[model samples]
Target: MEELFKEYEDKIPAILLEELKSSIDKKTTKTQLKKMLEALYEEYLESMVEPGESVGIISAESIGEPSTQMTLNTFHFAGVAEMNVTMGLPRIIEILDARKNIKTPMMEVYLKEPYNKGKDIRKVAELIKETKMSDIIQEVSINILEATITVKLDRQKMKDLEVRDSSVKRAVEKQLKSGQVKIEGDEVLIKVKSKDDSLNDLYKLKEKMKSIYLKGVKGITQVLPVKRKDEFVIITAGSNLKDTFKLEFVDTERTTSNDIMEVYENLGIEAARAAIINEVYRVIESQGLNVDIRHIMLIADTMTASGSVKGITRYGVVSDKSSVLARASFETPIKHLINASLVGETDPLNSVIENVMLNQPIPVGTGLPGLITKVKK
Candidate 1:
C-alpha cells in the first residue's frame, strides 16, 4: 500500500488510491493485486491516442465494419404483433442521425417496492395506457337529413376500461359547445342548433368527437407488463417521459425512454449522451456481436460535446468543423467551396483530412516532432 502511493501518488488521484486500497484488501490476494495493478497500468497506457492519430477514421471503421453483418428486417416481439423493434444497420443509422422522431418510440417504466413485487401490476398497466373516446366507440353515424351525429358506446368495453359514461358525455359537450347533451342508454346524440350549421359541420363534429381524451396517461397508446428476472416492468408503446415521471409509483431513476431528443429535453445533455451510448451498444449486442464500449463512447461524446445532439450528416457535425476542406470532404464539395469563397474562409490545414487532401504531412505523431539547429559558431 505504501509502495503504491509512493509510485503512483502523482499519476493517480487520492480518492482513486483510497478506493484501490479498500478494493485490494477486500477482493484480492497479494499475487492477484500485483497482476491487477500491472493490468491497470497497461490499460491506462493503451487508452491514449497519439497526437496526430485520426480518431474519426478509427471510430467509423470500427462500427461500420461490424454493422454490415446486421439483419435488414425488423424483429417482432413474441405474442405482440404490433410491437416491432428496428434493428441491424437501420437502427445504427437512426442513432447516428440523431433523428427527432424515431421509427418507434417506447418506454420501460419500473415501479416502486410493492408494485415491482407483482402487486396490482395489471391495474397499473391499465392506469398508464391512454384511452380515447374512439377506442371504446362501437359505431359513429352521421345524419345529413337531421344534421346530427350519434355515437354508440360499447358498455362492456367501457366497464373494462374503467371509463364512466358521464365522463364521455362531458368531454363531447365541451368539444361541441352544446349544453343539451342527450345520453340515451349507451348512445350520445348531438344536433346542430343553428340554421347556419350544415351537413359539413355535423361531419366535422363526428371526426372531432372520436379523438376526445377520455382517461389514463396521455401519449401512451399501449402497455404490456413483462416479467424479467424477478420483477415485472411495464413496456409502453409511446414515450411521454415528462408526464410518466410525474406518476407517484414510478421509479424515476430506472425508468427510461428510447426517444433521444425526449431524454435530452427532460434529463439534460449528460443523460442524452449516456442514452446514445446505451442505445448503440444495445443494438450491436442484440445482434449477438461483442464490441468494445470505448468506440461507442467516443462517438457519443463527439455528438454531445456541443451541448446538443448532432447527427453525422452535413447539417450537423460536418458543418461544425473548423476546416473548410474537412466539411467539403464530407458532402457537397462544390457548394462548400462556393460558400467558403463567398465568406473568404481560409484553411489552416491543421486536421488530418484537410492536410491529407492537400498532400501535406499531418501535424500528428512523428510529424509533430520538430528539430532546431543551432547557429554555426
Candidate 2:
C-alpha cells in the first residue's frame, strides 16, 4: 500500500490523495486501491477549466442567474433570540456592492474554556452588550420649576454591572458638564447651574443623561447566547469586531463578523477575499441555490485582485478597466466615453467588448490564438 501510494503521489494532487488514503478501507486489496486512484485522477482531469475559456462571463452568469431565485426577505431567527439577519438577494447585493454600512451588521462570537460550556454565558453576553445610562436606570424625574433632573438607578441592574454609586456620580458629572451631580442613595440629582427656570433645559439634560456611555463594548446593541451543539456562542446584532477581540475570554480564532470591510480592516486582503466567498456562498446556500464554489471564488478573486476590495459597479471594478470601450459598455456609457475621449484614450481591441462593438470575434475560446510569421527577406 505504501509503494502504491508513493507511485500515485506525483500523478495526483496531495489533498485528494490524502482524502482517499483516509477514507479507503484497509481491507481492500492493492488492485482495488490502484483502480480507485486512477478513477479519481481521471475525474479530476475532467473537472478542470479549458485554456482560453471565458470563465469570468460564465461565473458571472452562474451567480447572476441563481440570485434571481433568492427571496428579498430578511431571516428573523425564531424563539427568544429575535435577531434579524439580512439574507437572500439583499445580502448578496450588499456583499457584491461592497457597501460599508450593511443593513444588518452582525457577529458570531466564540468564547474560551468554561464560558463556551454555558458557564456564566448570560454574564458573558451582558458584558458584550453596549450598556447605556438608560439600561441601568429605572426612571428619570424632571423638576419643572426647580430646573433639576432626578434619575433613579435600578439597584439590581447596577449590582449586576458592579457599578458603585460614587462611580455613577462621576460618570454622570463627566457626561453632563454643565450640571452638578449629587448621589442620594440609589438616585442621581442633576442641578442646572445656569439658573434657568425654563422646562426646556431640564428635559434636554434628562434626555442627554439617558444615553451616557456605560461599560461594555460600544455598538453591540443586543447579544443572544445560543447553544450550538455542545458549546454556547454569542450572536450579536450590531458588530464591533475590533472591540470584541479585546475581551479576555473571547476566542478570536473562530469569532467572525459578517461585515466585509470590518474584516478587511482587522485582517488583510487575503482574509477579505475568503470572507467574500464565504459570505456570498452562505447567502446562496441559505436560499437553497446550487451555484458552484469556483464561480464565487472567481468573483471574490476579481473583487480583491487590486489588493483592495472593489465592487462590481461602474465607479469600482468597471472604472479600473484598461479598455476604454469596456469601461464605456458597463454603465453611464456617455459619461465614460466622454471622459475617455477628453483624455485621448485609445482602445487596443485586445478584449471582448471592444471587438464585439466592432463586429469582430471576441478574444476568447477559438479567437484567443494567433499566428506569428516571419517574412523571407
Give the per-residue lDDT of model 1 (tens digit) for 139-205: 9887777777788989999988898978987877787684357889988887767646766777777
lDDT for 264 in candidate 2 is 90
Per-residue lDDT tens digits for candidate 2, residues 198-243, read 6776777778899988778899999999988999999998989999
Each candidate: RMSD: 3.7, 3.0
C-alpha displacement of 4 in model 1, angstroms? Answer: 4.6
Per-candidate local distance difference test: 0.85, 0.89
- Colliding pairs, model 1: 52-364
Q: What TM-score should be assigned to candidate 1?
A: 0.87
**lDDT at 231, model 2:** 98
- TM-scores across all candidates? 0.87, 0.88
Model 1 residue 120 CA deviation (Å) reads 2.4
